[model samples]
Structures are given as structure tokens and as C-alpha cells.
Target: MAGRGDIGVRIGLSAVIFVLDGPGLSVLTTHAQEVAPGLPFGPFDPTRHRTFELALRAFVTAQTGFRLGFVEQLYTFGDAGRDTPRAAPAGDPARQVSVGYLALTRDALAPPSADARWRPVESFFPWEARRAGRLPLIDEFLAPRLRAWADAEPGERRRRRVEALFALEDDAGWNEAAVLDRYELLYEAGLVAEAARDRPEPPAADDAPLLGQPMESDHRRILATGLGRLRSKLRYRPVLFDLAPETFTLSQLQAAAEAVSGLRLHKQNFRRGVERTGLVAPLGRTTTGTGGRPAELFTARLGAPEDGHAPGLALPALR
Candidate 1:
């Protein structure tokens, strides 16, 4: 058996790509391409690469033409059968490990072609609600399986799993930061495409849609990892500023936060949070109202840590 140290760590990158929201807070995308045809998996070229970060930047730019901004390491995925078989001579029975990263970019960048798409984040993770609505996707698909899993074992063990996974029993509330837990739950229930090959047949419609779009190999899972990181990071850190334009009205900044987080915010409360955080400095300018009164504009306070020290923004709080 291969020891833990013997595992091969292949340096690879995946972008949890996002774009600016339009009027009424609509999500957009610039680079939307299929993984296989655009980026084929092969040997990690050492000579042509200087560092992993540089290689990721180069790969994304070369493949989709979108320049990346505000990128951070998301997670590392390594499972025995995760990677597709390598080409003939390169065939090695070693597991492939991928280092995922999250990236934010402006929609000004055009995606390569039709094979790639920049659909809203809702298209995939429908459970992430931006409006004041319940996630039917979860109620319809995930809840049942989670209940089953919770009920599998009795006593404290079972109770804990249920509470941790579903936030049930005590109205403990859903912890949005548990992104990986949510994905893994869906995977174990065979609701996601990543584990499709392992199962004999397709799951019922209730479970089918929960998986969202299937990416090449485990790319979708990697993408999910990145998405989870981005969502949680927004709360404690000022990373959202990276996605905003230079000067933006308070409402525009809130919209940007909602677009990325997939949840709405209370207008007054959001303004208060921004003010308390002191992350945005007033621009001393105002813009005419979209329908009501004009609003003041501000820019994200720079020179502080990339990770800001604010009351982490939450999707539910905003809603």
C-alpha cells in the first residue's frame, strides 16, 4: 500500500469564476467553456512553469483569456480513483491531487466559445438563494437523504450527524461555511455526478438535479470547493472589495456582495455594517437614484490586510 507520504501531489488549478451583476442584481460570466476540449489533463510541465501560481494564471489566460484577480487557494482534492486515466505511456496507478483556487474577474473578458458558458451561480448551486426564498432544491432532494443518513445510527452519534449536517432538532441554524459538508452529503447520497460512475444506475429526478452541471472529471467538485471558500471569506474578510469597481454607491457594493454570496441583504443593516467596518472611505460624490433618491458613493479602504477585520458578512443576515 502507498503510504500517505508516497501520494503524488499534482499541482493543478480551478477557478470559481464570477462576474458582475447587471441591473436588478443578475449574475453574469465572461469565460464559460467545457473543461475537456479546452483544458486537457496531462503531465505537469516543469520546464515551462516557474511556480504553481504562475502556471495557474498562465493556464487560465491561455485557455479562456480572462485575467484573474483576488485569487486564493481553495482546497486540495485527492482520492484513489478521482483522476481519469492518463494517456498510454503516462499511465501510472497513482492518485492525482489537485490544488484548487478561487478567482474573481470583471465581465469585460469574453469567454472562448459556446463549449464554455458563464451562467449564473444559481444554475449550478440552486440551494444558494439570493432572494428571500427557501431553497427548494435542498428540501426536495438533499433533506431526505440527509435524514436517512442521520437515522442510520442510533443514540448520540446519529443525533450529532443529523444536527451537524442538517442543523436540525434545535433550530441550530444552517452554517453557510459548511460548503464541503453540503457537497459531501450530496455526494454520499449519490445525488452528484462526480460519484455517478460508482453507482449502477441514475438516481431519481429528486436527486439528479442536485448535482448540477457535470464538469470534466472532478472539476465541478473543485469548483464547489472554491465557491464555498469565496462565500465564507466574504463574511470576515474584505475580499469582496476585489470584485467591486473603483467607485461604487453603497447599494451597488451591496449588490456585488449579494451577487457573489447568492443572498440578499437588508438595505439599512448592510449600510450600517459597512460603516462600522470602516473598510470603505467616502468618495465625496453622489449619483442620481435608480428610482428613488440619489445615493452617496464610496471606495473600499485600501492598505489594510487583504483580509479585513469586519463583522463577517452573512447571506442570511443580508436577507
Candidate 2:
């Protein structure tokens, strides 16, 4: 066993895989020792793999029986001491540095393993979802606690952050890309389960401060980073098509965008915006499977020059 004097770094890859699940978006999660499930992850073996992505794909398949497609490197999580529990053994003295990636799938396929399953993203980050309507949890549960925490001394700075990231007041609007920022703020305020675990003098878990679930080590943080990256990409790239069927109704397309953004869209406005982009074209067919009215089917112009040059889908959020 290495002593405390022995310092080392281990390279790990965490997969934040997202898939469209009906009207909601879900992430692929697996578990081992943590109270909550975490992203599919494994160590990067320099000797066994030629590239980091190959190693990530290999272990994810090994753990969940799922394969990865296009993935973007989201961030490098090298924060000292934040991942001590999962870095190695209890006192192995080696730090864990994870390279996180974001992946999107057309469907939420089953993982074929009990340990791995599709869990809705909103379940882990309840306050972020706004598709159904206003989240009562925000006003009734989270906001009150956050306000009290901010009201405590050093108030102004804290209060302003709370208002901005969460849109606590009408003057501010929630930034979908601030997912990790919000979580980190909650951590500092000792309002999250992770705070209790990480801070010696933090508000105890008994406080039960609207704990939005906790995953092992820094997995939840990595998940938030991926979510924020994807949400930001929506404004400039039509990458949502990667999570959509080859042919889909405009409504279905809009639903996919809404699921990822965690916001509702004005129906006609969204369709008009998508049509203007020229990223998708009518299939000359219809899908009555939509259950209500027969909706026109359209396929994405994936390789068209116009598509490659086009901007993202237009999302006019309903105020």
C-alpha cells in the first residue's frame, strides 16, 4: 500500500450518455458503492488502449452492454481531493483525474444489466426541469432553503448568485447551461447531500435539504457538466438530431429539443424556426402512430451542404 507521502494520478473516463425517453430526457447510470447511481466509467489503461475514447467505449460496453457513438470531450475533472473516496483505496494516496465526455442516443435502449439503467435527468436535478410546468419543488422546497442560506452573512454576493443561476426572482431567468454552477452553489451553501459528505462542519444530512440525490465521488458533478455543455450546444448546433429518429414529426423534433433544454416551446413558433433552418425536409409520408392526428414525417438533411452550414434549431421558449 502506498503511504500518504506517495502521490500519484489515475486517468479515468466518465461517460455521460443521454437519450430521449418519451417526453423527458434520461441519462444512463450504473452503480457499485455509492448511494446513487453514476455515469458509466472506467480507468484509462495506457498499456491496453491506444486512445482515451477507445478505453472509455471499451469499459462502458463491458459494464453496461451498451455501445457509444459520437462523443465530445466535455471537461477534465482534476480537482484535488474532491474524488478521494473513489480515487483509489481509502488511503492509497493517488488522485483521480477524470476526462468526461457527452454522448447522445436516438433511443433509451436497455442496458442489459441490472446495475445499469436509464434514469430521468430531472430526477437528479429536479429544479432544472420546466417542461410540465413550474416546478413546485423550486418555490416550495429549494428556494426557501436557498434564500435562508443566502440571507445568512455575506448576503449580497450569495443572494445575487442564487437569483441568477436559479431565476429565483422574475427579474432573472434560468440559464440552462449553468447546471454545474447551480449545483456547486448549492454545495457551498451546504444544501446538497454532497455537501454533508464532503464538509466536516456542513449542515448534517439529517437536515434533509431537498437532497436531489447524490452519486459516488464526483460523478454527479461530471453529469452536470455534460448536461450544461449539451444545453449550450443547442443554441448553435442542431446536435439534437443525433438524439432523434431518422424520420420524425416536427412535434417529435420539438419534444426532443424541449427534453434536452428542460423548457417548453411554443408549437407553431418552434416548427417555423425548424423549417427556416433547412436542416430537415419532408419525407412525403406521415406517421399516424402519433396517436392524435396524422403528422407529416421529415428526415434530417444530415450530409447536405446547407445542413452542414446551417445554425441550430430555433427554440422560442413560452413565457
Residue 5 displacement (Å), model 2: 3.1
Model 1, stretches more than 4 Å misplaced?
A: 1-10, 23-43, 85-94, 112-115, 153-159, 167-170, 200-210, 305-319
lDDT of each: 0.61, 0.84
| Candidate 2, superposed: residue stretches over 4 Å from native | 1-6, 33-35, 85-90, 204-209, 304-308
Residue lDDT tens for model 1, 81-179: 665522213565456666666677655444664434455555555665535545665665666766776676676765565567655444456665566
Candidate with the greatest TM-score versus the true structure: 2
User: Residues 1-319, candidate 2, lDDT per residue (tens digit)?
Assistant: 9686787888888999999988888999998754567788888889999999899899888988898887889999999867553435666556788899999888577888778999999888887898876678888778888888889967499888888888888656668889999989988887777777787675844444446878888888999999999999888888998998888999889989999999988999998888888789898989899899899999998565643564787778875
